[model samples]
Target chain A: MTGDGAPRTLFGKVWDAHTVDTRDDGAALLYIDRHLVHEVTSPQAFEGLRQSGRRVRRPGLTTATMDHNVPTGDRSLPMADDTSAAQMRALERNCAEFGIELHGMGSASQGIVHVIGPELGLTLPGSTIVCGDSHTATHGAFGALAMGIGTSEVEHVLATQALWLERPEEMLVRMDGSLGSSRAITPKDAILSVIREIGPAGARGAAIEYAGSAISEMSMEGRMTVCNMSIEAGARAGMVAPDEKTFAHVRDRPRTPRNIDALVESWRETLFTDAGAERDREHAIDVSRIAPQVSWGTDPGMTCDITEAIPTPAEFSRGDESRRAAAERALEYIGLEAGTPMEDVRPDRVFVGSCTNARLGDLREAAAAVRGRRVADGVRAMVVPGSQEVKRLAEAEGLDRDFVGAGFEWRESGCSMCLGMNEDVLGPGERCASTSNRNFEGRQGARGRTHLMSPVMAAAAAIAGHLVDVRGWELAEAV
Target chain B: MRGVATKYERDNIDTDVIIPGTYLKVHDHAELARHAMEGIDPDFHSRMEGRSILVAGRNFGCGSSREHAPIALAGCGVRAVLAPSFARIFYRNCVDGAYLLPVEVGQEAYESISDGDELEVDMAARRVRNLTRGEEHEIAPVPEIISGIIEAGGLFRYRVPE
Candidate 1:
């Protein structure tokens, strides 16, 4: 690795490259290459800048969008909620007053801030990025050192284009194997399995570099899904060392650099970890045996394979009474009986959207899964594309029609139902099979139970009216 | 012992509960203060009246990167948040804003600290003594990097002279 203790991991290399000042104490002022902004988190940051009378240091490097509180139902009318409308209007004023570019409503670029940064090629390899949303780690899929920052940090980045950050230790998780040959498991399952293995707060104080054959073979969309959940495991960020697949995705994207200069390619090549590079911790998973996963509890760690049973508190506790006590509470909140087969877990709603699994590839897979089948009786299923562009592409390919034909509501793009911020929400105590990231209590609605699964599985859940193992369900009947 | 400790015995307290999405549009600190911890404990705002510190279980501020979460707590008179662990983004936000000190403690220390206990936090000594119990518990010492940020009253004020 760097001949001893020198920066060796890809994260270390990028951190070293972008460092603006080395403080006496171990922290550094990192020059943020990209800063993404949104309605939920930026208004206060803009206020901070105004209070200080500071001009935005680099408006060109920052991008803003309206995502969290925006409605995905109708674009023709104003937001029905006053708070939603106010936040959207405030973001507009902030962007205009600061001369920062904002892809607001009706703009093709308007989407979840995390999704647009990568799709538009704003997220790049070996550069640092930050958004005031935890899922900003999604951009790390492109091998960028991306992180979620707080509102004050958002203001800091806006005012100085830099964030004072403490260097985190590195962890490398390698999943090597071919899953497609036997069973199909998407990156969503891979990461959920990882979080399940290492508890919710397991990777605290670490930046993870996902390596090995499986990660390299994953499509850009899959990598994004995996990296998007890095924060769920409490990792500062997650990267997949920009490879050919990563380069291919960014190449020719509308917002990417005009040309892939040879010099740039060579530098990106250097971003890889040197052979024998020492990691703070290393983990490996035999991905071949991994099945489609689903979270049964509020947190991401409380997941199991679809074929498995809802974990009993006794199984999770071992000898620890406190652990068992917590699991019991979680089970109570989820309203699922222990030792029950996952297949029997009924879901009243099936939501397919969020920064997590709302991309075009995700929609295509979901559309494929329920081509000829109809959503089960009494089940409400909806598809909110990650971005407006994704909706456009899905509609262009008739994917929207397939979903709509199957009784899935094909709606506009926004972070809908992922959190109950928007009007889209579950009635209290209603259970849902969701493609969104977090299943926290009230995330969908107060007392609403959410099972986190991949898009295909969620679609299958809609048709089955329960959590079904998509692997054996003859996924996508004759598209 | 100096300030009173407001104990919250819960784990994985996400940002959503700290400051719900409903008030995310409210930029006023005082307004946020009245709503802080209202989601999880409707009476928490009133309970935190004189206490300037919060003691909690692991993984406090676990979801979303809402700076308002910490800002809300800060406005509610929380000068420091002592937890066994914290979500990375929330911890960084606390350091960046100098809003509240994120004190790391072991599970033992977290359990030992009780509500209304006068906590005399000695950062230099890495010790927190509870006047109520007349007991001392060692806390995890923060890296110099973080303490520097706390001392400078935030990164904005921590700038080197141009």
Candidate 2:
């Protein structure tokens, strides 16, 4: 239904529908359907609006939350950090002045912006969503054209509910083959493997359409975990074609449209890319070959299978001196030798949460891993759910008890320790097996080493006291 | 515009390295300035004493959408960053925010330009002159809308057509 009878991609269809104006150079004014705001990036934006005498154009479409700096511990306690307290107060004042609804720190709805958007159903299929935080791409799991914008664009959206943008070229990442019968292989692993195959900036300037059997078979939460890390692969946005699973996930959410079935029927017609639509580039990966991946170096691309040893600088030096130097630096910073077996790298801490793997399914995976096992001595571990709702759901399922009984800290929801903005952070020189995206130097804390992995892998590392392959956990425990 | 370059001949120099997350709470330009490039170079402010341009490898500002990266750099008096390529969001952020110019250079220019080289960039001519080395290089032409944004001094100052 591209009107001209030519095949169109999902991205093309969404772009055409939301374009308010187009220029000769292909730049178009895009109508933003949803704006998810968090404290870290919105202060300057709201300050800009106040200075310009501009009110939020459509406050109803905008939602604010305190996530980036909110401490996950004891909400009732006065925030000991005065600077963080001021930032939170600024957001509350701005939201009040702008008349935008805020899911403040104590609100049950308060959580990571990306997590609550989908949970509340603000992120709908075929909608264009933007947030200042990079993980805004997480909403693309529902087939929304979601992207992360900067504070300037955030102000633009607040002032006009639109953004001027040049459409990104489309890339197709066809994920063929099964992830196998074992539940150990997760969406986190699948995406880490994809980032390894494609370098960190592999999908630069393009939007990726994840397709094929593996994506189709993934549960909505799993698909979200995959889409959330799309930004880490250097794609501004990544999405899967919405289908029954997407609709079913939305069917019972709080913000579904009044005419759900009718909306879905229309979504079915236009939300999918036509069979012969052209892709600017195509890449394929067999999901069956994907194992639980662990990042050894500074970036996500420096990942390998849990069973593989840390690679040497010479391995990266083949025609790329920059990569080789980066490798050498990463190895030195991460405190690992090239030939060290991944299993030999014992973590000082284990973090089983982040926007990437903090959903209900992810919690269930981690709980299953540590149901009866105790955390290793001298290793500190914690699980921060993606949202308050996820925490409530996990507690209802006794997952909290399992984590606490196994000596893991079960905390409230926020982006805790993921970016280390709050009190939860790794001490200097402490190495952690983290489920968060980005293994960049000091991502968790200043001079902290991060090894990115799946929830199960992180949980196993907590019990085993090292980065052990989750696939071989049962055998190792039996022996 | 003419300025000396501070070169980092590497790829994927992310925003976290440009401005660490710990300083994200400090929105004041002066406070943020003290921490510019704190992750990669603890002495970045001192290093910025005479330099106003940054020359780097590919994918500069490749992580987080924190406008603080460019803001911190601008606060520290960095007017432009020249790289072989850039991450999309970062490029747009620079132009839209008018914090700094993110110029895309070719392999030849990237290799020829050295740290501490005196250079003059002419946006209108789409050319760069390495005065210290007596060499010149062509830069990718700024897109039509981007040039307009630059002329207007940021997106807020520019008017979109109805």
Candidate 3:
């Protein structure tokens, strides 16, 4: 489509390709390739249709799965929790009633809606995917313009098979240079460090496309980790241009075209920003200097490198009054003092699972951290794989043994700790170093305090009985 | 409806807290509303029966773009949510669902209104009247474009123009 005869960037091309109607209000109605639905948000939308006595506009375009409410342990039907059981049943009923295909509980393909979409070869490059889950951005790892929507919006999509969204201003986040040697740093660390530097509002109203040598070299799982948390940094969605890595990840999948070579050639054309193409903003991070990051507060923005001390409320107060209040509240809730070395901030729990960091690599890294060391006494630790396939592959390599042997609870796959949906919850006033996306108050459970971190760091905190630098564990050497 | 605002003096009150992630499975509005704010206060369902306007600090509904949040709140009979700011997704969800009205009143307005003040929200006038204090604070109104959607009961009804 371009002069160079290669796809510039999946986003660049897809943005142009899916233009159904651009409104004067700046929003465009873009055609969606796949609509992934889950139990948590689809019911009302279906009800809305039923009330109107209308059939699904396009049943073939949508797929349903049960993830948010299903417990991570025991794949048996009729969930142990009555409320969860009802919700799962409701999903089964809704899917069957609407004639929508569903990967119900215990299905081999069943997992987090976001994880299964890609693994099942449903998320194709250059396609527009919408799910009710925020981490739907995970599909962008394959060069799709994947974004999350609300129930009403989900209903709108179901009715029209399209979404009206204001075109996000473009931004390029280039992570150039070689990675740091601390071995504790990872793509998760890189993204967290970037969010810390840019602040939460930095990427507001932008569609951020990650680029540069570092991003290109990352595996598909690593890219998913980066894009999954884009919303945390206030981006509409984060995307990586599809490349060889993207093609390799989806090449043999069910939906990928059999003419792989030609498909790659066509997809390559969508792989980069046009020369001198206009962008609203551009920022670069020299990955070499970043260290493993940990959140010491209620918001993702309130984070610092592991080596740094907790920030005093007074420090933030001088800058922005709102930030100051947030810092003070974070201190009050987290029960931590400003200027306290983060290493000294011990956690009662360590959770290494979420759409953000629960991929195979994250498990491998966490397993490496806990391979030989036992979980410290008085610390509760868990390892929930992101997907069933990820769980299978981890067990195939005995990664599960390393985790279980270290005293961490190795549970079945789903969005277990990422959201406190099932029994996987933290008790009141309990402090946790979580690998999940959010650190909001009571996110893990009622009165449970969450501190977001990388999986390796979560493992380190579980072992050290505190939020310590994961590099101190010498995980790389263990491998 | 009259009651003192037992203000949740915090910012970024995410949906997970408003409706715990566990309650999301239940499709029954009545059932889901029963657990609304159970994560924050166990008696929230009982406390928020016919009266109460949640007064939050800033950016309420700040995580996980879940629509059940507003639905759960409305089902529990919450009249309005007054905060300094709201996350984009939650804001849009509330508007589209036409359940709870989100008013973006400045901090000064929040400071002036005492915790025990009985107030009435005049949606049409874009103002909050503190009946206890004999004072009224003019709040920025929802944009006409969005108000129309709410007036029609919800997005579904709004889409079918008269």
Candidate 4:
């Protein structure tokens, strides 16, 4: 905060206070309040620490889990994939060696690191968090200044609990209008809509705070879903100003700061941007006509409304040769012809688990979508909960039964089929409706074409065995 | 820092291209190095051949927060990477891990130097000499703090208890 009584951006207040050392070149060393680690990016960092004989300087500040490579089914059985087993084993070994708490297989706390953080209240309004995984930006939902750090920076945080960061340019994304009459609009759609308007590099080198009525009315899970993909827009992080809803959502969590909960609450009240804070850029999205989004191209930004048609290369007005070439290639890879209706676009698989959409709320929405319908034949459909707790809660409510009875494989929790690390993957040349972030080539599997949609949309696709508009479509068909 | 350059012209060359996720399972540094830039250039390892310097377009390291991109670059014998701009995390990783020197040169320099051009970099002076072209290009700034970290030989050595 400036001493002269100037209004500060929410990012400014948190960032300025965390600046421990500022260099002449404007690079700042900011202290990390919390560090989250996952399997893939940590092994090399731990190795570097071992060579240096340095213990984690603040063990209490760091937490570890195995998400990206762990299996989401039948945990009692040994992992069939040898390399994945080894990666998970490496995380367990590194965490045990370093005295950091790990929530590994079968642990109640074990889940996607992003899911577990807010549930445990570790992600607070005024904190700064860093994780080796890019989706760590999800924690920014509670107004925390969270950003992804590379493994080397991971090691730096472990050694000193401080990371060198340059302050990012600030952008305000005001989701102006409501989804209007479309009650089916999900946060996944809202975010996909944002990405569509502003391409992948839209918010690069910036910090984004999502505002407007749509954001305010969104649930914590919805906010999580939105912030989880801020990295997809190439933003350093995305946040929502913590309001009463955020306060209520985080109030009684196991890790909510009990001692400082009140003090923190008071401090959080000051974290919102003032009326006249300077915003480097602002984009107002009038979402009245926005529908549940689906990406047809190779990237998240190449998207259209569910009612829209698959765009031809000519639809891309951008004059860049490389971008046009990339779009044309994506259409070829996805096997979607130009000007085809997005409706009834067939898929070989439907996946509903990832940090982006595997939460309980997502499950409930999906369960409602396929309550009494069986998956269409020849379409492989599966449901892997985001966390063990989500799975347990869903099972307690028999949401798992609704899915299993509907011919969906109700599995355990982890990042399954999201990045296609383990056995869960799409077959060659197969198309899938996925509720995961990122639609890059082979993201779901080798040579697999992915269509990014909401969990409910994925469920609808699985039941219909094609891209069917869930909008106004009857949930159950007559016998 | 000086070496002949192995050039890649595209922008947003992500880590997935640096070393694909499939090869990430293999731990051996040399093995990883073998696959570095294979996504973009299958013969990257053969092409680099210990050239020790890399020249590329803007946002050289873009997606996925993996230091393996730089680690694989280093393991393949790259000493310095010159780019007009770089993804933030990748830039920090270059300095923190002591993987390679990241020199921020101008776009003119990026377009001027071709593959196999020998180059000399003087960070203190903020310029690069294209020995092959017998010309010098003024680089944009490398953060003073970053230079300090590089001089101290990476983060681990930089913070050694005095």
Pick the TM-score winner: 2
User: TM-scores for all candidates?
Assistant: 0.96, 0.98, 0.89, 0.92
Candidate rank order under lDDT:
2, 1, 4, 3
The structural similarity of chain B in model 2 to the true chain B, as TM-score, is 0.95
lDDT string, candidate 3, A40-62, tens digits: 88887888888878787889889
Question: lDDT: which is higher, 1 or 2?
Answer: 2
Name model 1 segments beyond 4 Å from true.
A1-7, A181-184, A477-479, B160-162
The fnat scores of all predictions, in order, read: 0.59, 0.65, 0.53, 0.40
Model 4: per-residue Cα lDDT at residue A390? 89
Candidate 2 residue lDDT tens string, A1-479:
24898999998899899999888888889999999999999999999999989999999999999999899889899998899999999999999999999999999888889889989888899999999988888999999999999999999999999998877888999888988756789888989999998888889878899998999989989889988998888998999989999998888888877898998999998899988999898889999988789999999999998888998998856668888999999999999999898989999999988889998988888888898899999999999998999999999988999899999999999998999999988889999999999899888889999999999899999999988888875521210
RMSD of each: 2.1, 1.9, 3.7, 3.0
Using Cα atoms, each model's DockQ against the true complex is 0.63, 0.78, 0.43, 0.46
Q: List the residue pairs that clash in candidate 1.
A: none
Report how far off residue A240 is in candidate 4 (Å).
1.1
Candidate 3: list runs displaced more than 4 Å: A1-12, A76-78, A281-283, A476-479, B1-9, B30-55, B76-84, B103-153, B160-162
Order the candidate numbers by DockQ, best to worst. Answer: 2, 1, 4, 3
Residue-level lDDT of model 1, residues A176-267, one tens digit each, is 88557322478889999999998778787689999888887788899899899988988889998887777777778788787666636775
Query: Lowest-lDDT window of 10 residues in candidate 3 chain A?
Result: A1-10
Prediction 2 global C-alpha lDDT? 0.90
Number of the top lDDT candidate: 2
Clash number for each model? 0, 0, 12, 0
For A321-366, candidate 4 gives per-residue lDDT tens digits of 5457667877887888878878858888899999899988889888
Stretches > 4 Å off in candidate 4: A180-183, A475-479, B1-9, B50-58, B80-84, B103-138, B159-162
> DockQ: which is higher, 3 or 4?
4
